[model samples]
Target chain A: MASPPRLRAENLRSALAGPFDVSVAAGRCLAVTGASGSGKSLFLRMIADLDPNTGEVWLDGRARSAFTAPAWRRAVAYAAAEPGWWTETVADHFPDLPAARAMAARLGLKEALLDGPVLRLSTGEKQRLALARTLLRASPVLLLDEPTGPLDEDSVGRAEALMRERLAGGAAIVMVTHDPAQAARIGDEHLVMRAGKLEPP
Target chain B: MNPIVLTPRDLAVAAILLLVDAALSVALRLGLTRALGIAAVRMVLQLLFIGYVLQRVFAIASPWLTLGVLLLMTAVAAREVAARPERKLRRYGNEAVGLIAVGFATAIASILALTTALRPAPWYDARYAIPLAGIVLGNVLNAASLALDHLLGGVVREKPAIEAQLCLGATIGQAMAPLRRAAVRRGMLPVINQMSAAGLVTLPGIMTGQILAGLDPIQAVKYQILLMFLLSGGSGLSAVAIVYLAGHRLTDARHRLRLDRLA
Candidate 1:
């Protein structure tokens, strides 16, 4: 079988990440679980190369330093608990509307929401839409920080289905969450983020 | 014309603002006190120097000298705007070069062409061109610098979110969409406010100067209206362009937000 696309983090540390060392394989959904202030999200951040860390990382056997930041990120998708919305219209968030719209619709968003003001979007709507935008282009590696959080039963189910589809497309997923039941359902392997450690599932 | 003098109350208010600004600045970083100091002191020094320089220049009436000073001022203002944000702090000289080349040259060319070429009167006129450019560039510079600081600071703060966008097939420019838009909008705000406030509530510096210079009230109002529009438009473009340029500091050739190279 093909070697699973992997990201090896050799001791990543930051104000948020602390000090972490782990290698995450692709086609494998890795869930990082921890309590509040446990650095779960920070671990995902350093692995994703979103924040500054002292540790080195390798993606797909190539050093992260080998690829420019934009190039690396293009191949890796990350979502935060809070995403910045910079424009009045939702369509402004994505370069192409059809892609964003298609994924958004799958997550139960209407086409009218595209042209409507983004300021009007609810919190759950914001999270779902951000996830949709990510799912549309869903990169080879995905680092998600609470992509689905505190949602009702129905929305969580839809999100879980979407996550599976992304996995089917062969993306390495690194996710941070506290919910064990949710983690068990979506993650192929689980990792706990506590005291700056990526404990294997 | 009676020399316009600040009343005792006006002086008191100025003292209060200066004192309050200094107190607040001690607690705050990013040179609010320095700006206040510049506002209070440099405005005086600049005006003093300009009066003498203009007196001599107005007598000599050399188009080249007036032209030189105007270019120098614009270039200097642009450098200040671009230098306010720290990229590498060590590599700031390169940033200054870029800001001067892009921001200064662009603003200078437009103002010169518009004021001199199109509305050609007694060319190399200090009375008109010098003050006009100063107001435009000075206001816009802070806006530009603030925008850069905000965007970069936000990038570091929101790196994961931005990186996430790129990982999901977003280009560097694509990833920075929110930031770029925010930077430009935030930069453009003051100019927009001045445009909104030009005539309704307060007399802007330009109109006041024009009136003090013995221009008729009606003619001064007309000039102020036109000047406000031009000033707004020019500063808005300069501020936004400087912000984009600031973003270019981090992104590589393909346009990803690269913080590694920056200090």
Candidate 2:
């Protein structure tokens, strides 16, 4: 039998989202598309255990409860739609400066941008940098909430390419996106969320 | 050199000072006259009541009675601490946390001072213990309340940032470290300022009273220095304890930022 999927959610339910059952294997991506308030973000948040939710999530066949919350979150990382930066400078947020610089370069961000204060960055720039911050973790499962929401077409393409590289390295991805074309391009399986339930498009 | 005793007639003379403040409120339409009158009456009544109680307690000098008064004072201070914050924990969580911190810090500081520094005969002597505990409780109450206010407000304002840190695989302690530090510092600020300004900008109340009671200036300064040390130490302990306790309440075993816990 094939090995268990890298990330599996079985009957995950939260107040605002999910009774969601989904699976994404290693080297594949599950792209979720939904309207503005269809609970796409909340679904991913439940999978990451960022919000209070019921039911089970398994990583590499082990239950979410088996690992500590921090460890589970480390392996199953969630990048928020508008991620927060607590520090004044961008460099303070990243543990590995050179790796962040490389990731920034790949995401079409300038090296100088990494050294400046985060407040000065545009929304698009902040979004990409946040993605870079999450990507550095090399988590086995990546949950991206509208990762390319504010990026221009060219930048979006670059961000997608970077995610594809993570997939190539056997990291499973569950992404929430608004762009059907982008989802079609990068997603191994596409699901539409409506009223907290996922359905095939 | 005995202190001059002020009779009721002399006290009435001192009460005349409020006329200037009342006149200003009336003329400026600050609308504080009612509040001012009520507050002045309350202060006089409360102080007189406390003086009577302390006089009786000193005569009895019973340890149980002394402890009872201290606990009563702490409960009142804890309630004050709980009510000062704009945002509060649901139920009386803030009050419970404040009581624990203030009670613990006050006990430790007063016990240490009485045993090692003052060495009052029969250490729990009402005269020494009541006044010292009162002073420590007053400072600890301020610190605990201020720290709680800062933590509750900070948690709400910085929710996103805190949640972001948790998302990045941070434990609750790690996520809350900066906020805890900021809140404790905010709480300790008043005592810090008072310590730095003591004898330079202003004579602290206790020392001023000691001097007025004809204690030697140098001896009064020594007592003031000791009291300042106790106040600062108690404030720091209470601030740290209250912030950590409140922060713990704001999060959970799963390290999630439980914003629902706050009201």
DockQ, model 1, C-alpha based: 0.24
Tell me the interface RMSD of every candidate, in Å: 3.9, 0.8
Model 1: residues with Cα > 4 Å off, grouped in runs: A1-6, A10-21, A54-59, A62-68, A89-117, B1-164, B177-237, B249-263
Error of 2 at A119 (Å): 1.8
Model 2 pairs in collision: none
Best by DockQ: 2
Worst 10 residues of 2 chain A by lDDT: A14-23
Model 2, B16-109: lDDT tens per residue?
Answer: 8898899999999999999999999999999999999999999988889999999999999899889999988988898999899999999999
lDDT of each: 0.71, 0.93
Q: What are the per-residue Cα lDDT tens digits for candidate 1 across A126-156?
A: 8998888776765778888888895678888
Instruction: Quote each prediction's TM-score.
Output: 0.62, 0.96
Q: Candidate 1 docking: what grade?
A: acceptable
Q: Per-residue alpha-carbon lDDT of model 2 for A112-143, expressed as tens digits?
A: 99999988999999999999999999999999
